[model samples]
Target chain A: MVDDAVQRFCQQDLQLREALGAVIFGQPDAVDGATCALLAGGHLLLVGVPGTGKTKLAESLADSTGLSRGRIQFTPDLLPADILGGETLLPGSSGDRVEFRPGPVFTQLLIADEINRGTPRTQSALLEAMQEYSVTISSHRHRLDPLFSVIATRNPIEMEGTYPLPEAQRDRFLLEVQLHSPAPEVLTRIAAATTIETQMTATKVLEPKQIESMRQTVRRVIAADSVIDRAAHWVAATRPEDPTAPEPVRRGLRLGAGARALQALILSGKVEALRNGRTHLDDEDWKKWRHEVIRHRLVYSLEGELDGLGPEEIVSAVDRAVAHQG
Target chain B: MPASDSQISSRSRRRTPTGLRVPRLEPRLRAGRARILRHCSRRGAASGIAIGLPLATIIWLTDHDPGRAAFTAIGVGLLLATVFASRQRRRAATLWPRIWDRIIGSQSLIETILDRQQQPAGNPWLDALRARSAHLPLPSPTALRRHLPAPDPRPSLALTATAMLIGAVLGPFDPIPEVQLNQDSGSTSVAQISSELPTDEQLRSRQQRIRGREDAALALAGRPALEPLARQIRGLSPATTAPQSLLPRDLQAVQAALQRLAAGDPIIPEVALWNPLLALDSRSPMVTSAALPGDGASLALSTDPGNEAVTRSTALADGGSDRPTDLSPTPFDPQLSAAPIDSIQLAGTATDDASDLRLDTSVVTPPGEESAASWDRVRDDPQLAPRWSRVIDLYQLWIRGKEGSGGG
Candidate 1:
């Protein structure tokens, strides 16, 4: 039974999807993955080459969800303090006390553009705020809103001077949605629309309370033991070290997804099931969303790369193998 | 009790009739699995024979007994097919549960129903999953098989059958009968002939003696008393040693005569076949013998072993001839016949190019079934082809000799 809160959240999610579709033109999967990441209250990573509208899509997410948005354009020289904020001395009535000036990470929605352009040290600074939902500057912790979400974008690693995101930083993202160049029809539509100054603004479809409430409703979704078993099996199958790893993983992978991947899979599956007007998780939900949720978390072996095994192929192999498992 | 549409729908939604129930699904799943296993076994048997027969035929071609080699090939093929079939069956059996999981998971009702069976959620919201997947379709094994492609063994079987038939009929595996004509006088019959051919000197001497005697017999044909018999003998002679259609039959008759001669008998069962009386459609006939009733010291004048031509000559001298050849009296050997041939050249005709004649002595026989039955013939029968038996004996000896030389 879909409760009133879940119903409202699903309706709002559909409205947000429609709104993003109007502006994004052809990237329905990317928009849906981002929405799911937002509803699940986890970070999203948008991976694509430049000029694919990854940044515009993130901006649209911020606009469509009615959340206060802030952006950080990561570069090689970016520092931790730049993202987590710094304290400034302010004279009060009684004495001088240090006031924390929050960085761009303080807003309800933060879009870190070209995140891989930042060095690992700079990237690690967002880890605490992303996982703990709070930033600590000089032992003073500043809490973020319950609706806080990070939608990050990165250029293809082959681009010159771009740093690759480490496995740990990549694992923090709930979903890695790949963006592609628009098809001919969508490109034609985009060209036709952009000829004149058409300042297209997305309609705000959800509030902070609604997002938080939807997360609560998603948490209440029932995930059966068998569904959990399949999820665990799938996650374990990614690890090449495990004896039970699927054939592809055994041959191509050096490292597998950890327990965190399983948690994300099950949690995202619950959200997926709830959004589809169901209050219980099924393997279908897990199978459908697993590639996005777990792809970034996987570490393929050098041999796997040399053999031209992509994360999508590896994940699909595991999916097919697990689906055939007793 | 009367109920509203909502209540009726909700009631029906809680347990969709077609949703998988563990109790019911187990047996159906097992049956589905059994069907797959049966299919594998059936496919293994059909394809195994198809593959085995041809493979066995190939094995037979290496100068092996056609019967035994074929059986070995078939046995080996079936063994391999069985192993592969069982492996496939086990694989299908092991994977069925995962297949069931996906099938059950597809139906929200099945998943919900299974969850309720395992652990019932008290919240009505969670219970609603049953209704969400209530209308989801359930699949049957036939439907699944239709969706998934399984290999059709029929085409493979037909191809294999064709291959096996071709292998049996035309492959080198069949026996090529090598008719080594032991024309030497010392070599009495096939059974008495040694495996090795006569040396060149012995062959030359024997050939010369036989040629000289034949010349003398030709000269003696001018005598009025021997003219008819000489004409008959000339008519019986092969027009050429290059085997003609009549040669084998003639050779078989000669072989029967030699077999009887080797047995030290005066009469051969095949004597009736060579009798000129039979060929001439003459009613009057008499058996001839080299030793007349009263002359034991006289040498038999017949060149052909076991023929009663000398007895016929003596009868003509006595002027009595009124009987079928089958009733002809048995002959006697005075040991004065021309020496047996040393080497009866089995020659083929030369082309118009005037090239030296080359003979193809190897006579190919059809492939026999390589099965338990054919192997039994090889093992148990005494009348099987001597060449095949000799080859088998030589193979066994070679194996033994190799083992001995290897110091095993």
Candidate 2:
């Protein structure tokens, strides 16, 4: 039974780009990708040059999508207990015994702001809640809500005093959305809106039930075999070659994207197609998803110049190489 | 009917896997798991000599009226062993077909051999090496022996029980044969079975196997036997390393070769074969030529019959007999001719009248029900797959020859 409530609610899921920008502003693509990631039952990564308003976009998308916001400002010192909500026997005022006090990690939207700045030891604490949607602390495993998600962010320019993500950890994100500087016109509107007398707070449009139903609908968006095959081919082409070969492998690219890339590709493609109001994923759907699905996972060579090449550029090259190989 | 988004998967009807599951392995896996659990449970229940012991030792141990206890133990052990073996066999059987399919999936023998990456690593030597070993004489255990050595497989009483008994009795006074029969002597028998050399090719194979393990060779063949066995095969290793142990057959080979040379018959050292073989002529009963295949010392490996024109060779026989050896159809040299491809031919040589193995040429070229298709099915029996796989693997090993060359 298609509940009329869920059916009536997702009309806003159509013009979501505009609704998200009412609060986030200058991050239409990030908000679009994040919203789709939520609908597809996957996670999102918002990586950009610092001060690109990624946090603003995340907050607004959480609002426009009608999800309860759970904020976590990740730091080098943040403990797993603080984020994952471990069992601490806090004594009750009744003078009897203690009880478990869950942490902020229990919410639907877990915003790991500046996620990579935290140490891997601290960052990995969220990995369980990110993937299995669960946390195991002190041997008590608690599976989180099925609608639970993580919108993690990292800045690209800073190299020093930063705990940059290792290759293994970068592979977990569903979409590696790279937020560039907004165009001059968009920035002008952003500047005026921010400095204005009346500030805009996000308005909730989706209920908890609507969010759950939309997740299943997005999953039902059929992915064509050829489009997915092309996606897989590109990821495979990026693996490094052995040194003892007659000639060296042309690039020192580490092993290709993990299973998460396919996951991101399918989810992002579903969102892309649904934005155009199509039922199936197509070539254009993959074309839109290429950067979002692949960027962060494209680990380059040890060469200094190549290391600085944006993940977006490497992923594009990979796509072209795969098409050529095909 | 399409289930709605609100409908829970739990409420949906579950049926036997018509479309419910993947076609292969799922049901098989569940059944295999159940069998394993049952075997483990029996092993847990068994006491005395425990369970899963070898049939031969169990029978031999119980020879001296080993009563209800030994019989019960042997019965339980055999029951468990049969269960364990059938499961192991099934798993091994499943594994072989999968491996064969995998090898078939490979583009060439080179792809089969050096393609250890599971996917392409863009390595050249490994690619080339894999190409060459694909074409060798690989045999099946159906054409060889069936079973391997049956070890003493029973578990012992708890160490706590043994220690308590030892502490009560002044040192210890269990009957010598009764105490250690299943221990050192039973293990000795097991080791002997493993060390038993089936053929000269197998002898070389054993030599090759032990060339890396000196202490193991000494432990296997013993100090008295291994010392000289080690010296004879010093330069004979395919890996170029001599083992420090010996076997009885290897030493006997050296002694026979020395005796033949001293006697001064028409013995040629170039063929690298040394044995006191008494050969009989196909036509005449007197004349003999013991020249065989396998580096001129192993079994008869004939040519493949795919090609019509066989590349043939005929050796001149010069036995120290009054009758001159004559070539019937020769202008100046003997032109031997026959169908190739592992053929069956009658040859009378080194007639060991007491030998147990009845080497019928018929068995070598199996006929009837074992036609090519059925042969594949029979050949894939987990019991026989390793032997066939070995034959192919050895062909690759031969092609690669030395490690200093490729895949460094």
Candidate 3:
């Protein structure tokens, strides 16, 4: 009894996963997370060490989805005007006039590489476009493509000459896809494959309209009250001051995920349901992607940092607490 | 392809414009709820048996009726367990749908349908979900039974049965008898007082009476020959001052006096005969009057003359006595008086011979130390006079009273 649109989206989603998996060697979770973010019409933040293929994942996701791609290598000297275009003066045939020049962000899929290297002012420039799917240049609003999504990559090991993404900028992301180091077996395959003259590339598996239609179908996926309640409980358990918060969370976290995190969880869960050919959302759908959708939004306290508590530990504590409550 | 008007109307009729319909899932949910309640009741009953039987046994051990206690305790335990099971069932009612969904592997489709049933707008996805749920296999009754397994009653039943068996074997307890003592007077009864060994006050009163009788006997026996008789009486042991020994001692003293008379001594005056006769009749008021100082001088004068003349003058002098003439020799029977002395000697001989028997019976020991066999021997002894057996019985009662007072 699957809807035709959901069935079609599942078929396209399988091809997209295969296309991303070909180039991204061993990170299946990252591929699924990226696909889920894309299909939900939300931004994704890629976090991993160097040589773990964070940039490659962003690029492969853009290629596999067939969306118009744009790249921005963030640097310390990058300005807000460089990311979200500004007005410039030009000599016209009639008289001297000002013209609005579009930046690279006008594309459907924008890849912000080494996003943390940019200053706070430059990072904030993409926030509105990622959220509202529109850019405001000199009060002249410009709507983005219907399938606009940002796949930003950040190097976790490189702290030098980089500005950490602020809370406001981090919350704009629906999920932070963590790409782990490849296994030894996967590394041997990667070594033999990468040394060849022919480079690995992702072919387009889904059209832009199909992805937009999938996003609409994902939105239409029915989330029952129980699933929504479980998601709400999981997000609420992350806050340090919440009564339902576990001891580890109350001690290790300073700020919990907000309402936006709940929205991202249900929205991503719906996309996950569609990928699994389920017309209705289930608890498993939210539970499967809870860490990715919630880990980045949590802020650790000074004590927690001193105690070496991380976002992964906090999210795991929330998971155990919510499950025990059930 | 386009749908015909009739076909479109049929499709619209099949769909609920408001929300999704799950006709097949509700019955399964109801069955699951029933299974949950049944499981709760079984667990509650097991708990009730585990707690009730021991409580009933405790009540039975305290001398209460076993059947009544068991019935009351088990009834209360069952009532409480029923109430608790009902509460558990009510709390579990909301969880059956979730359990049903899990059992059937619907992946929360039932919950989704339930939630969708409240929504005003219908979605094609929800419609498709309902359609898919209709074809999903319903959970088998065996599966539901497995999901809610019956609580094991064997352990509880075994423990309860053991408790019941113990209660049946032990039966109701008998209450111990309590001893009551009268503390106000420091004594339980008059027989208790008489049967116990004499206290100092009683000893002094007996000694004073003996000394008065000795003085009257010395006044009446006014010859050198009678001095030896008085000395013999004085030589008797002081232990004979106890009331039980008084009768035997007096009899011995009178027998010694008659032996002196039979040894060719001059016949003593009638006043001398009064001492032995009055001693035998010590409870008579005439003996008390005869022992007065004025009667003693008259009795000494009566020893001075001829018998008839002296008896007449004594009767005139003792007219104030209740039985003045009865104390005279005219009323005395010599053979009858002598027969008592012979019987007294025989009784004393029998007592000496039965001393070994007394040791075997332990009748003379403290009543507290005496056993039932000792009391039976005392009662059955052929040689013990009825009067002495009665005295032993009173002695036993006195000892019991002493023990009671000490316990209190």
Candidate 4:
């Protein structure tokens, strides 16, 4: 019965992805990645230049899911309370009462645009809400919706005044989807679509209840032991201290992802398998989702930075090492 | 989300052979694995033949020592074939997963089935999976073979056969007649030396010397007590005394007579003509008569006492003037015969053919030259004497009794 529901949800989610793709022209991979993170109940970090449709993709994602959406334009001066909500004094009938004003994080989908523009303290405020789906403000626990997903964006070009997200905060996001400029043909199609006077609104492809149900079904999607083993082995090989790590990884890595990385791999792998209409997961999905899962979590060493090596190289090394196992 | 007991039991009731109803896919998987191994084995065999045949053929064509070439070819063929087969087998073993994927017609279904097989505890998800997969058709051996790529046989067979044919036909060839001609041409008219029986004059001179030694022996004996042995020695016909044809008994008699004379006086050694050609070369011992220009030269012979007097006087001076000289007239004194045989041998060439060369070790010399220039020609000849003498040593008997013997 659960497999049947997951299959139905997979079809619905693919339709939602198609709807988002129509709004975000020429970014099919980004749209699919965003849809996967949203349906899997995990946050996404979009990295790209200023006008590559990162915010537009997030907005389209909200519209297609029909989830209540909130936006916070993070700046250098932004405070933790500005994102997580703060207590305000309100006058009651007989005495003054302290009430909490819910922040933008209290929604189904929250978009933190230019998240690197905010200080590390303010950026870390969303870690709890992104990971636990709840915010703790002044001893008061406010639970966000179970279907909440934070879609954060950062402009890679303009970095003069912005504060980059710390590794701890970056690790909360399940995927860091990179957005690129569209090809000439796609750019032309985008120009044609924008010049027309007709207003385009994304149709609601999934409801909040359906998303919650899909998350449950995603959990039930069978991850075969070998697929889990493959993901675990790859994640283990990412650590420089791990015996299975290849030499390149040992040379360049300072900090490796923790068990959360493995969870993200298996979860994303399950989502990919279900999307492919397979009841059981396989290493193919794990390979497809590895870079997105590991890219944000890896902390490179000083030499690695000097050598201009990035997480993508180490992730590729880990992948090649695991591929040769047996 | 988990399957309930009712769902599992109900699915079990409707099991089909295509899916969950098949008790084990291990058998099919094992069979598929074996088929791939067999394919790899066949490929490895083809590779060995392709590589080994050409290599062996090249070796066979280039090797000059045909005695060892066949064995060398077989050894190299087996070594190359074994190395190639081992490498190919390793390559083929790594393709097992790909083979599994190809045979099952699905990407991860086999991994799923194998993963399920690893779990000892019952799994509701696995059961559900099996039930869902039950509707899909199982892969048969025929289907697997149909899915496999076709075998290739072009370059291996053609290249190996061509190499073998070329090695067999166009390899090195030399005929026996050409080899023989090369050997004969290499030996063309190089100077050759030959030895024969002594000439009549040389034999006569040798008999005269032996007679003189017998008379000296009788003198040393102090009486005619040695007369019988001297008579036996004189009975040797000087006209027909062929030293080459002397019997062992006649030599023993002469040796006994010399030993009796030596018993009377220890100064006497065995008397033999150590060199005939050099003895015949002196002016008085040989009378040279120049014949007509076309005919060979005529020569007369005699033993010269004048040369003997000169040789004896030289020996007496070397013995020191303080001691009185004994006029024993022994041709070979034990003291005079103390040097090695080759030091006293007159330089002469011996024949290479044993049939033409008769060596009388008792009196060693080469005789019977057609002319004086012929004797000179035999002495100056370089390639003939040292080489032939190494095989047939004629002067060894000059020192036969005395360990350090030489001429007077």
Candidate 5:
């Protein structure tokens, strides 16, 4: 028995997904992941090879959600101040006053492209804004928009001159959407659609305020103890030291998902339930999105890398082990 | 009004206080839980009975009374089934909501309702959820049965039936009693008859008897080569003459000795004939004698040589009496001729009739004829083989020759 409010929210969510899908061809998972991340009111981390429409997905997410979008092309020389604006002394009629200039992160949706290209020191600049939704510069605190969300993209193939995100920074992201290459048929459609004189753009489907309302509704969605227990079990299974951890996790991981990962899983699962027009969180809702919410938060050991144990494999193993326990 | 705004406003109205009416789904939830518990208990009881029947059959086969054992087994099975059902019911009570949710295909609606019941009221989401699930069907009995199917009792039932059938066919039977043989008794004293191994003393006694018989046979042959055996026989202890001491081989040896003695000389010593005859007659108390065929003289063979009646019979035969005396005594006692015979009157019959009161001794058959008649009766009997038959014939001839000499 879905509520009328949740039913309407589901309708808007469907529209938003359709608009994103129209803009970004053949990446329904990416579109859904991006939509769920926004609705969950958490940041997204897009990981794929270049030209897989990672940036397009981010832009489409912003466009479809009707959030003000800003783009930043991360470079090796970029500084923390470039991401979080600093206070500067401006010329005035009487006395020069230090005025704070908000950076691209201040926008509702900030697209940080090739985020790994930035140095670790510069890439960490968005952490405070992403987590606390506030930035501190020169002993002054600046609050970001309530709808502020960072949609960051990283090119997995471009390893040279790129600093990998530290565990702390990666933990701040709610989900990591991996965009795979389009199939041959999808590629033809992409090419035909993109080569047109007029470029296709995502139509706005949800206002920023409506998304906020939906976020509130997502919070109101019932999460029974059973769902929380399953989430706890899955999170516990990721740790190498946990009794429930599988052999793969114990052998292939140095660090596993933490409480934040559990929070992100349940939060995103709530939004997923609302999108499915349910007022309660289900095991399937969380299970379907577990990899996205937990994969990037895991830190693989040297042995794991040598054994070709990717985060996907580790997370999937933990999921299987936890599911088997249930 | 745009359809989208109208729909949004309508949804907004659902969040108001008026729309916060939580449906009464608890009764249905409780009913579903009870139904699941009942199903679980029934299945548990079925399983218990399936396991219990076979164990009871085993008890019955162990010599316990069939009716009592079967009743006790069924009682224990029911008791265990009750205990197991209680446990299953407890477990099912806790797990029913989740199971129901799974059955109804609701996304944890029943569980959410249950969880929400524990919290403070007035949650619109819970109310809306209840409203949504108000019309959701409780799992039917058919569905419950499908999910918690009864345990298959075929294998256990088959085993129990086979065991019961076996128990019926082979009813209660006594176990074999352990018998401890006496180490001291040279025989099984507790048993009326036993085929146990002979003790050391018994074996030694049988061996000595066999040796004595062998020496006697060699000596009676009267050959110069057998003189050493004859001397050995003269040196043996007289205790070897005990009839009970003779085994089957010893008896055969003694018979051969008598045959050899008769072949060497027609006359046999009286003592030699008496000793072997005593050994042969150990299992039977009767001693038989016959008169010479044409001399009209009789001989009486008796273990008690002092019996006057036998002496008188022998004297009469020596007197050349044509009528032979009855040497056959009553078969019950070999000494019946020497002892006075007593007769008891039948309780309900007349006591005054002299014919009924007195013993009939007037009708006498000659000993030779009686002996011939007895031989004819038993000559072809299985126990008397040709060898034994020949031994008896020899014994009768010796008796006749002894009688003929006495008459001369």
Candidate 6:
């Protein structure tokens, strides 16, 4: 099976993330979240307040992976054509025209910095491309590269002017990695590293297609029945309709993580396990990403901002409530 | 040394999906890039790039001269031809959209069914129909909405070639002429040649021909099977019009949005309203204006906050099954006097696994206002349109689900 070498190759894969950590520190979970997403053959959604090096972390990931990079900086004035693109007819010399042009969304790794900064209209253009891995324009269709992913970084605290990423956009991402401010030591290390023109070379280890196949292999990694059962139970217990859901979830919440939220855990769990060369998923893999998988999916009492009791807290509470079921 | 994060990331080689397949990306990418670059520079390559000619100025320079104009035009034509042919050869350009389009088609089916419910006439019969509609819930304390079986009929088909083309062009490129106009144009002989074009009259004629073809295409596409049905309804007496056709194009837009989201196509907001599903079902004539607000609120219960589980099904331990059924497969409820309908739809063209559930394609809604907002958001996505087009998926799953008196 290709997974064998990939399992062995995961050691190499692990090393790359490690190298990235040397330059960017204190956010092991964020790194793990991104790693898990990459291995699962899905994209990552990074959320945090501004000035947290979210952009830096994504850049480091791209550099470490040696994937060709493209970026779209979301702005309120940004149009759908600015990100997803449309056919732009450039005037040709003999009074003819140049063909249609594509936009920044077409790349091996697309870093959509401050994605929520864009308007909802501009924002939805990207949501579909992320899910379908394709775009339709001017009577034709375009497919994204196998390794194509939009590592969208969002600023949750600065919601005053930004539009929320649609729920469908949230659903499409394999992981929603939140970047906490780097600890003083990590910041110090980053500061020291940036003292110079901070250019480091990552060996060209794998091509986009190769990386894609490796991801498929990672998906094939085994997740034991019990682990799957635990994941399913955890998902069921979060829904307000589920009798087993927590008091907070049932009383205050409007919805719970349906089957897809459960799948995110199971799928990412397998990727997390295999990256460590472990054949079967363990409980820790799910625990590691518990927050990332279900955070945005939770719908708290309409008091989204006021009730401090968001999906993260509910998931943690549900995790506690359902521990015995595991 | 103990393994570290950087150690892992640094060593994480981009490997191929197949065994020992260190799939060569450099060549592939370079080839792709070369194709793009060649397409970008093809005209210049043949026409002999003029080092000093400002790209925009070159046209002015040639247009001013009577004798040199013809030569510039010929060069422009050849350059344009190369660029055009090379662009057409863009591998898999249509792949992603083609795949997504199939998903859109699949999702569009959901809107079709929902569209059936959206009558132009808001009347008592519509209320009776809502009460009668299999998926609509009856106003009750304990029970949830009664679901109908809207089964998916077909699998989607995706062309690989089109996908590659899409992926190749996802990155940004310097627009050849426009950039040259401002900065140093990579103008050599090729720039001059690529710029050559037909006269304005010829261009106008070509545009007219293309528009005509496009109109024909739109006419074919805009025509729905329901249009004839609509025509039949239009002929109905005014008395019956209110009862028979209650839905509007706006409602169809909402339905279309749902199908798009369901099929993993991106939902589009260009429609009349943002929250179509959550939009009030005023067509039910029995729905008195007295309880209008309550109707909107009651419909909100259809979705819930599903945070813990994303996409997994299993057989339960308490002699139960956790698998999500295709919505009341046989109508487990005794209350339903009608035989459970197995309304299998045309299946999606291409999917991850027709049998294996993809959380990306179909949504599992939450059962409250939160569910309503989230459902509306995702349903509006055109990318998810394909699954939504298979409108019956959620209903069918619910219909087939094991019905118990209360939550477990």
lDDT per residue for candidate 6 within A60-151, as digits (tens), equals: 77877777788989899999988867776677678867566778888889998998888888888987688788988876889877788878
Q: By the DockQ metric, which is better: model 4 or model 5? A: 5
In the range A267-304, model 3's lDDT, one tens digit per residue, is 99888888777888888887778888877888888889
lDDT (10s digit) by residue, model 2, range B357-380: 122222122221223333344334
lDDT of 5 by residue, B271-363 (tens): 232233332233121233232232322323332334434444344334424433332332323233233322111111111221221212222
lDDT tens digits by residue: candidate 1, A1-326: 36676787688879889998888878899988888888887899999877677888899888887888989999999999898889989999999998888899999999999998899899999988888999988888899877778889987745676788888888889889999988899889878876768777677777777777878888878776766887898888898887678778988887788877887887788778867776777777867778897778877778788888878898878877776875
lDDT of 5 by residue, A1-326 (tens): 24678888888889999998887888989988988998888999999987899998899887777889889999999999898988899989998998889888889999999999999999889889988999999888999999999999998887789999989999999999999988999999999999999989899888999999888888888998877988989998999889999999999889999999989989999998887778899888887788898888888889888999987788778868986886
lDDT-based ranking:
5, 3, 4, 1, 6, 2
Ranking by TM-score: 5, 3, 4, 1, 6, 2
- After the best TM-score superposition of candidate 6, give how far the Cα of residue B94 lies from its true spot, in angstroms: 50
For model 6, the stretches where C-alpha displacement exceeds 4 angstroms are: A1-3, A90-98, A197-206, A224-226, A303-305, A324-326, B1-408
RMSD of each: 24.1, 34.9, 21.1, 18.0, 19.7, 48.8
lDDT of 6 by residue, B275-394 (tens): 212222222111242333322422211122231111111111122233322321132244431333222111112222324222221223323232334444444546443444243245
Name model 3 segments beyond 4 Å from true. Answer: A1-3, B1-63, B158-408
Chain A: TM-score in each model: 0.95, 0.87, 0.96, 0.96, 0.97, 0.89
Model 2 residue B226 CA deviation in Å:
70
**Which lDDT tens digits does candidate 1 get at residues B25-102?**
323434654555565555555555555555554555554565776677767777867876676555655444344445
lDDT values of the candidates?
Answer: 0.62, 0.52, 0.68, 0.66, 0.71, 0.53
**Regions of model 2 farther than 4 Å from truth:** A1-10, A92-96, A241-252, A304-308, B1-408
Number of the candidate with higher TM-score, 2 or 3: 3
How high is each candidate's interface RMSD, in Å?
2.3, 18.2, 1.2, 2.1, 1.7, 20.9
- Colliding residue pairs in candidate 2: B52-B77, B109-B130, B110-B130, B110-B131, B226-B246, B303-B341, B304-B341, B305-B341
- How many pairs in model 3 have backbone atoms within 3 A of each other, for residues 3 or more apart or on separate chains, i.e. clashes? 0
Candidate 4 lDDT by residue in tens digits, B1-408: 767656644643445443544223444565655666666665566667667766777677777677677888888878866776666656765565455666665667666765565343355666776664545445555664575543355665677678778767876644333234443465432212112547687777666666665664454243233344344445443222113322233333334444444232322321222112322232111124342221342323223333332343344334424342332223434443432221122222222342333322222222333344544443344634343333223323332343343232
How far off is residue A142 in model 5, in Å?
A: 0.7
Q: Please, what is the TM-score per model?
A: 0.51, 0.42, 0.63, 0.55, 0.65, 0.42
Error of 3 at A281 (Å): 1.5
